[model samples]
Target: MRWPFRIAMSTTAVMLFDQAVFAGQFLAGTFGALHTHRANATYSGIAVLVAAAAAVPLRWPGRGPLWPVLACLGLFGLIALQIVLGFQRLLTVHVPLGVAIIGLAAGLAVWSWRPDRVAA
Candidate 1:
């Protein structure tokens, strides 16, 4: 269960990083990159949802803390809002929110790998 959660978190973090790369390419005048970015945003959102699902068993049986579950849910909500902002071309909020999403995803991945902390 822990390993599954760790993998999910790591995958989500990587997806978020790829999202950033695509965004940068789009900003650099690559029109096709915007399409890729939008597609990856959906994938990233799915990945976060998967991570959240994985986080459930970690806490349900009292094998771990509940923060990861809550964090993943919160992150997913932010990603949902992010997609809306991007579609609206609201860069003022979208840009910073994207950064925060990546940070949170990466932090969760890192935390998932910490055996002691994950089980606590």
Candidate 2:
């Protein structure tokens, strides 16, 4: 369960990083990059969803702490909202939210791999 969760979280984190890259390219005056960014945003959301699903078993059957499950779900919700904001051209909120999302995803991915955190 822990391995699955870790893998999913890591994947999600990477996807989020890719999102940032695409966004940067878009902002750098590459019109085509905007399309890539939009597509990657949806993919990143799906990755977050997969990570959240993987986290479920960590809390059930007394396998591990519940925080990861909650965190993943919260992150997914934020991503969903971020997608909406992006499509509506709301950069004021979207930019800050994206930064926060990347940070949170990275943190969760690192936490998932901590040796002491895994259940025996």
Candidate 3:
């Protein structure tokens, strides 16, 4: 659980950092530079999400096992779809979904590492 939490936390942090960078790239009007960071954050986010999903069944301190796993899967699916929407240049969907991901990932990471959750 700790390991998974750490991975999830790291990915969220990556997203947070990249978002700022993305904004900078946008402001600078260098769309090309954004891709590398975008790719890095997305790919790494997916990988860490997988790791956290795998950990869900191992020893999740939470009362229900499936909820955590499902949550991870749900977020994973959303992010996977988000990538597709991005490549297709669907800002209508992509930008909002990215915001969702940032919030969800950050929320989960904070929740996971909370002292109370770990104590349980």
Candidate 4:
């Protein structure tokens, strides 16, 4: 697998795991909206970082780690949307959007698994 895609997968997994842990506390209302906002900020920051770091690697002379980078970027956008939805208390949009992102990320990971698609 490409190193960049591996990184993407690992990062995504970490993000999910972190969110899961955060959810427990979030449900408990450990810090109220502060925890919620912090989680959103963290996700947005990660997406920006992932997109920047993967840009060159996914578009250079190599075949490109196209799917991983795109997936991360897409997720980043969705995360931003989620924050807005959360702020508006739009539970319907927020939940579905989050699911969509995870689904897309999984699809990207599968697509990136192809031998010729991922950067080395």
Candidate 5:
């Protein structure tokens, strides 16, 4: 129980940090610093993988934080797909997926800090 909540908060922090870095990447692209794109994508993929892995321990006994864990996994899947769509310049799916990731990650971040939420 304690582990899930702690891991959730930790991963949520990663999501928050990733969002910030994502915004910076946008800025970099705007200024023609395109070199950071691949680097950013690499780090973003790594962060998503780490978050997904952290979510595994959340499935221990008790109420089972299923949806959050699934969401993290789903986010990772969408990101992988997003990368492909992006590489193909399929802006239609890629853009919407990016927005979804932002909203989901932000929601998780806020949910993690809820005072009423208990670990045990």
Candidate 6:
């Protein structure tokens, strides 16, 4: 159980970070949006580090709570949607999905450290 969950969580976190990094590269080299893209990459990097921290104990016998895992799942889903929308240019500026992603990532990271954390 721990192994499976840890693998899933780690994979998702890496995916999240990878997606953001790709977006940054695209923005900087192709789209000429270096500053904004760099910021995005930074956020994604932070998310990765936080997620990694959470995953640390998950590899052990007694690990994280449910909310953190849920948060990661939710955040990953939303980010996947956002990534798809990016390809379609369907993401609107007024929409704050990016901010939401960051918030969820931060939330999940913090929640993962909670003593009573459980899997759902």
Candidates ranked by lDDT? 1, 2, 3, 5, 4, 6
lDDT of 1 by residue, 5-36 (tens): 99999999999999999999988999899999
Which is better, 3 or 4, measured by TM-score?
3
Better of 4 and 6 by lDDT: 4
Residues 1-112 of candidate 5 have per-residue lDDT tens digits of: 4455555545655654564466466776654333455456556666656665665655654455777677777767776787788689887886777777667776765665
Off by over 4 Å in 6: 1-30, 34-56, 112-120
Better of 2 and 3 by lDDT: 2
Superpose all Cα atoms of candidate 6 onto the true structure and report the RMSD in Å to 1 decimal: 7.6
Model 1 stretches with alpha carbons more than 4 Å out: 117-120
Clashes of 6: 4
| Highest-scoring model, TM-score | 1
Candidate 5 vs 6: which has more TM-score: 5
RMSD of each: 1.9, 1.8, 3.3, 3.9, 3.9, 7.6
Please list the residue runs of candidate 2 whose C-alpha ends up more than 4 Å from where it truly belongs after superposition: 117-120
Candidate 6, residues 1-120, lDDT tens digits: the string is 344434445544454445455566765675645455545544554555455455555545454344544565456567556656665667483136765665555455444334554467
Tell how far residue 52 is off in model 2, in angstroms: 1.1
Among all candidates shown, the one with the greatest lDDT:
1
TM-score per candidate: 0.93, 0.91, 0.72, 0.66, 0.66, 0.47
Pick out the ten consecutive residues of candidate 6 with the lowest summed lDDT: 109-118
Candidate 3: clashing pairs of residues: none
TM-score of 1: 0.93
Model 3 off-target regions past 4 Å?
16-20, 57-65, 117-120
> Of the pair 3 and 6, which is ahead by TM-score?
3
Instruction: Write the number of the candidate with greater lDDT, choosing between 2 and 4.
Output: 2
Instruction: Tell me which residue pairs clash in candidate 5.
Output: none
Q: For each candidate, what is the lDDT?
A: 0.92, 0.89, 0.66, 0.60, 0.63, 0.52
Query: Least accurate stretch of 10 residues (summed lDDT) in model 3?
Result: 57-66
lDDT value for model 1:
0.92
